[model samples]
Target: MKSLKLISSAIAMLMCFVSMAQERTITGTVTDQSNVPLPGVQINIKGTKNYAQTNYDGNYSIQAKTGDALIFSFIGMDSQTIKVKSSSVINVALKESSNQLQEVVVVGYGESTSDYSTRSYDRAERKKAKTAATASVALQGKVAGVQVQNNAVYNPSQNVVIRGAASVSPKNEPMYIIDGVPAKANQMSKINPNDIKDLKVLKDAAATSIYGNKASNGVVVISTKNELYKNLTEQELDKKLNIMPIPSEPTQEDYDSFVENAFESPRTAPLSTFSIDVDNASYTNIRRFLNNGQQVPKDAVRVEEMVNFFKYTYPQPKNEHPFSINTELNDSPWNSKNQILKIGLQGKNIPTEDLPASNLVFLIDVSGSMSDANKLPLLKQSLKILVNELRQKDKVAIVVYAGAAGMVLPPTNGDEKQTIINALDQLQSGGSTAGGAGIELAYKIASENFIKGGNNRVILATDGDFNVGSSSNSDMEKLIEEKRKTGVFLTCLGYGMGNYKDSKLETLSDKGNGNYAYIDNIQEANRFLGKEFKGSMFAIAKDVKIQIEFNPKQVQAYRLIGYENRKLRPEDFKNDAIDAGELGSGHTVTALYEIIPTGVKSDYLAEQPDDLKYTKTETNSNNYSDELATIKFRYKKPDGDKSIEMVQVIENKAVALEKASDDMKFSSAVAWFGLKLRDSKLVSNKSSEDIKKLAKEGLSNDADGYKAEFIRLVEAVK
Candidate 1:
């Protein structure tokens, strides 16, 4: 009788535990100390991979068992842990952390980045740490498990060991991941110390286990601030580096006509495809307009171009591909019912010494229209800097055209620098514009001196006024298309302003498989010719295109943020013969999409359609699935024929705007400004004050002072 009673009691206790184990969704709101809804708060069920971030309004619904603990964490906020009881709705209020935790590490890969217990060195502590310039410079007592012993003599890095390698063959240095790419010991010495943000040495197995065998010797993960904020403009870099432009009253300039794209329904058009655009001429042109205290014309603002103007330091690719891919999804700041999808592609940067030899042809338009000081004079100075950068093996040929095209200098070796400069200086401008002849002659000269497996290109410097034969935009495009087949690339450098044919030059560069840059002054020329030389010469990937497919079950309506001119038909994605923009070394491309998730009732999306009588209605595979969309990209090696594809699927990860990184927040501010310039309905209500505030907070390590310049621009506009 005692055994039966005991067994019955145990069975009742098991049933009670099972009753509480039923899985159910827990809806909640996350707030800050002041009761403000914290955006981007990451909430996850502890001891499990299930996680969700709080949306813009601090509302989040995630699946969890009644007995599980939920973790609520953000960057600067103190994390809160709570266990689920009978209540299905859990609201959490997290206080700000008085002391900064080491949570700013770049932890991707679906990992719960909210938690890192290891001690880390912030900017303050890093300023105190000292190391000699020699090999004996090791963190012996500084770090817990790391012991650096450099010989005062030979092999300086030989004694630097992290955790004393488990098995050593004399090469057990800790893996150094600088800016997302693994660096060899010799390469580590070259890294700029100013670029680093946080330095953390992962010595424990718990910290190093994430890297597997790569971490056997331990790991040194150094994170750098975004690249977009690091690049300095020409005028900013050197106040005296600009060409002196004669002060003339601001004149109106005409831009190519274009229309803003409209929102599209996923039910009718499920695929959004477009060619990648890296051109930033529009942004600089607008800046030029502003500098002259002139009102920018609405038509001159190309949102996509403006967004791509600044660099965004995305991660470098670790795979065989030449470019890295990164994406972020969040609620749109301007629209409550919409979400913003950000996609970034960064091309690998090739060092100047490693870049291939070049065969360059300078196509100068010495036409009568190019007589301005900012036009022909600036062009000559720019070419001189490029000539100085050429290697001994490189060759250059100069071709000029006014009434007719003719070669000013034959195929001259890069060593004969003075000869090239003399030829360039002798050139004079005073005839009818024959741009067609110039292009044809330039291509011929470039082709004649082409170097196999090398950088072969023609740099066209012009005011974009072509009045002779084949001057029509379509005709010039066709001519460029034919010449590009010869494996010769083009780079169009626009000069002057009023009467500048921006449309014609843009077309020529696009069809000729090249890049377009508008050099308004001498400082701008230095930026192109001196600082960004290799990036302009060496092509890494060509014909890069992006195709996004949003799950109809998750998304209701979507609109691409920009790239109105680069939009292509869905079928063109697979066609290899279709020419697209080329990605030069160290180039970064970014694209944004405004998406509306399903179940969120909004006036922007189309009405739900009834079941069709002629066909079966599409059904959701899983109504409650968290998948939002899948983005795929296709890119070809600079000289390869076949294209490679990479795909990434995004979850419904919505974080508060405050939780986003400075890279995301600042880029969004730039995108928001573009919309403001266009007067788009999307961000119409987003005031200049809101954008400036966000941008101020988004300034990370503005070491190069670009972010400061941008903030000044914002204040000027306001």
Candidate 2:
């Protein structure tokens, strides 16, 4: 009987292992209505991490247990989840997204379409760079272990040093890759301010080793925004809603969206806090409209983004913290009676050579929606520019999605330029868009090839016309939010126009620990991929937040200029779990406030009620000084989960607008432009001529010709 009991126990244990390991291989093909196989589709067991990527032929085999649900998904197609009973075969046929779109056409690689909307093609925000308007300023002083040196406000190049130079090469510069292609340090400086999204800095041996011998220096990665920026309505652009635009038209759903932000009261709500918003898409989109001779929309103009888009030339940071604090109080250009309190944060700059290795996935959308020459073709050329700047050690994988998603290239060394280029050339546009599946597969590829402390990212380039399954902005956003937890970052690049869904793209980029850029042409792409690669590709600091407490004794009412969307609750400033914008190496950020002195009377100020019947009014403490306000912010190292604190105090003394530095005047001019564009009640008396004159006068240190460009854009509006 004892022997029988022992045998029974053994049998029980054996059965347990069998049940625990009840895994079976499920094979299937994902396809569209045309019966064409889909590649790179994502197949996985529901509620499990076990997932598989389809091969080039759209064939997939995934492991799952009996009764477990298997999910199959494509980007623009409906997703299918099947429960495993006994059958191992699970074929899926995905159709186009049923959600309506405004005739977004996709042509083959070789064809040129007769689209009438080509003449008005346009589209796309982020971190404040230093004294300079460029992104490098924002990245400075942010990294804990890295040393950054900022150039003059106008100088775009920054010196970066990583993990104590173990070994050095000729230039001792780390290679940079933006969106999976190699790039030069200076190329990072040229990207459009609004086009940028996130930066990835790779350091240490484990991360650097992947880049081969060259990585002995380090590597920086840049991700651009692929989401929509702005699109004109068909009736508004072509005088006929019946004649749809080339890309897409804003739908009734989009037009029906409502958003509003009210002014704050200094009497009761004296303290103001918000997440820093570097997204400047509003400014550029305004330029496109004006250049096309179209009237600007009030809802589209974000005052904070427009003002923050220009550089303010504040003093660079000198302490252990990432950004330097610079404050200036001056009379407002729009309202001389009001005081303009300017606060500038200059993130320490790090030279490019000192950065780390990288692991990158180039996720390109080849869906029929991206068939325009400005979309797919332009995307290819832009990626080529980035590839040319790569080091032999960097690794890149190409993932494309359309009617279905697929991996056209595995992890190939950067030096294998021919192979990479050939793979790019072979890509063609057709079929429904499987954006969800594409993101899943691309991230899967990135995670699989991820290096423990390296720059791991997926650069997603698309036209923002997701329609198929799980294509809702919320669904795709949740998907990216979940994936970013795995230590992978995203860069979204928006291409083409019309069908562009700016809200969808911006949300995806924001949630994915990445940045967004609208690539209207190769010039913008080169600026992002070639010139500003360092600042564009690598992040030096993350989760940076700011809070300000005004002296109600010295100020009665105040308003922030451009960051309406970045407002945060005071408590959120201390919560490390709340993610904020990132600062790139040498990146700079600037903010402006229009304040009404305590003695001045302004209609915008809140009416003070007689001492409440239930309680006495509170009096100000420590009110005897000339201090204007106290500014405090929190930041964290790139990979850290916690944030560090930083505080700064300002004076109440005001300077004349003319007496202020050129940085102030230029940014102020941009602010007025934004206000005028929005028809803000605050700037009713201001005119475009005033803005143009001030912008021209403030064009000091115009080394990069950007100031000149601004002047031209302003003039075009006339």
How good is model 2 by TM-score?
Answer: 0.64
Model 1: lowest-lDDT 10 consecutive positions: 120-129
Off by over 4 Å in 1: 1-252, 606-624
Q: For candidate 2, write residues 1-718 as lDDT tens digits.
A: 9999999999999997687568666777888887878754667677765666565457766667778887776543567778887787888887654431222222112222221111110000001223222333233334544533333222335545554444311123556655555654555544443454555566656345666655555666555565221233323323321223342224321211324344565667867887766555556555555543456667657766666555556666777887788888888888878878877777777765566566889999888877665678678778887888777768899999887788999999989986787677556687888889889899999999887766777888887777776688779879988997877777788776556666676777777877666675666677667876765667777777889988877877778786665678888988877767777666667788888887887776556777778865465675556888888989887777888898878887888888877888888888777777666776645666778888987898766665666776675454
- Give RMSD to native, each candidate: 30.5, 21.7
The local distance difference test score of each candidate is 0.73, 0.67
The clash numbers for all candidates, in the given order, read: 6, 100
Worst 10 residues of 2 by lDDT: 117-126
How would you encode candidate 1's per-residue C-alpha lDDT over 200-314 as one tens digit per residue? 5665464466787667777766555553223344333223223233335445455778887777777778889998988888877777776645667777788888878777779
Best by lDDT: 1
